[model samples]
Target: AHIITAVIGSGVLSLAWAIAQLGWAAGPAIMLLFALVIYYTSTLLAECYRSGDPETGKRHYTYMDAVRSYLPGTKVKLCGVIQYANLVGVAIGYTIAASISMRAVRRADCFHYHDVRGRSGKDSCKSSSNPYMIVFGVVQILFSQIPDFDQIWWLSIVAAVMSFTYSTIGLGLGIAQTVANGGIQGSLTGLSVGPGVTSMQKVWRSLQAFGNIAFAYSYSIILIEIQDTVKAPPPSEAKVMKKATGISVATTTVFYMLCGCMGYAAFGDAAPDNLLTGFGFYEPFWLLDVAN
Candidate 1:
């Protein structure tokens, strides 16, 4: 559950745009490659949990501890600072995504009501995403007050379920859109590029897509922290961590493929950065946007 909570997030929503940037063939391949790489790195980190005899002394409870045990002098502090900074960046990114999603949902709801009433409702809500981001940040601050990792097991479980819920909804909507459109928007080869994009620009866009895929798959900074929460016999935490990593990665990969492939099939080069936003304020989509 912890692994799932860490691995799946708002990043999955933009995967279609990433794939659109890379094309169909390269997009899914890159995502699968990222999954494999992350799995390998997670197992490597799991192995670092215990440095000596498991029944004896000295286990690395956190990522910085592992770095400290292996590195010298200021390098240990440097690693700690870097890891925390990466985590903070991840947190900020997610918060911004949540705010954007909330804004989308609100717009969708307003549009839906406008459609039902046969009138425009654009001026109903004048709020921007910053307010929602601030609210989410405050909520995160409250959650952060929980000092113990183990104490948040239930929260992790809830987050995992929510992740699955929204992902399933996205996959289902993608399938529906594909069927309604009678086929994919682009050719089967999926090699199309956005309008006015030059050949050189294509290369840069593909590289950006690669970086986005890498960023989406990155959860190594938290692997050791999650592993530390496992209750197992000495040295067996690696086994538990391996199991969690496999399950989370496998499940998330399926969802990623569905979102990327089906989303591109539906929108082609016009795919938005947030897949859900492209659907607009339609029935059921508004609900899905709310759920997301």
Candidate 2:
């Protein structure tokens, strides 16, 4: 769910988008950073998972619960904060897609619009913007539940994730739709940066942009997860789980860096906005049709 939000708001290749604004030499550096962030995120998660809390006989003492306890507030206030943040996050979801769309349309010189008009006729899913998410998140969430077993807690998390997403729209869109739309209007607002930046320049920027967004998204996600765990406390085996989370982050970082490097190597001077898929030519092991 969070990754979906990141993709919509920042657009893929946000690392490349930012780097293209720099120059060609940024290729190696951006990849390195992506790897590092992945490391921190994964590491912290593992630590949280491994370093289990010796079960203080408290139900609300998960990872997230601990952090909030220090604030000296009522439980009601804490829950309110979480709800508020998510509401604001909903706006972010729409704004991200809007920003990327605006930029893409402008970059095409207003020639290749091809807006994604959903049944509502407001937005389209032409670029897997919402389809991949809807399918994976919604469909998978449903499929994950076969017999709707005799478990109570298990059923709740599934419901939480499902409840979070709203048909790919903004939170206060009706009221702040104008502001949200304006935030991304800069995609085509500024004067031309130059007389057509090189394709490599574009590719480099695309990779850079992606790396940056992924780094932020991954990092933020981890931090948030850890905080939640620490505050709220995980199950009895939470400590053991921390180690696994840490290992996953470590592995994820290395994989992300490799993905970036391979991307640069393959795209060299002709990388597209979504270069991760394009970079697959150099990575025979990557078995997905992300480029499609």
The model with the greatest lDDT is: 1
Evaluate model 2: give its lDDT.
Answer: 0.38
Tens-digit per-residue lDDT, 1-292, candidate 2: 2222222222323333333333345444554555566555545443343233445443332435544544456764776577567646654554444444433433332222333222342234224344444444565457668674422434544432432222111121211323433432212111123567666655565655654545433433333333333443444434544454455444433433333333333333333444322221222111112122
Q: For model 1, how does the per-residue alpha-carbon lDDT over 1-292 read when each residue is reduced to its tens digit?
A: 8888888887787787788887777788889999999998888888888787643447788898888777897998888889989988998888988887788788777776777788965678445899999999999889778777457559889988998787667666777777888988754434454578777877877787787788777888988888888886754888778887998899888888887778778777666676675552156745566566
**Each candidate's TM vs. the true structure?**
0.91, 0.41
Residue pairs that clash (backbone atoms under 3 angstroms), model 1 = none
lDDT of 1 at 267: 76
Model 1 poorest ten-residue lDDT run: 185-194
Q: Which lDDT values do the candidates have, in the order given? A: 0.78, 0.38
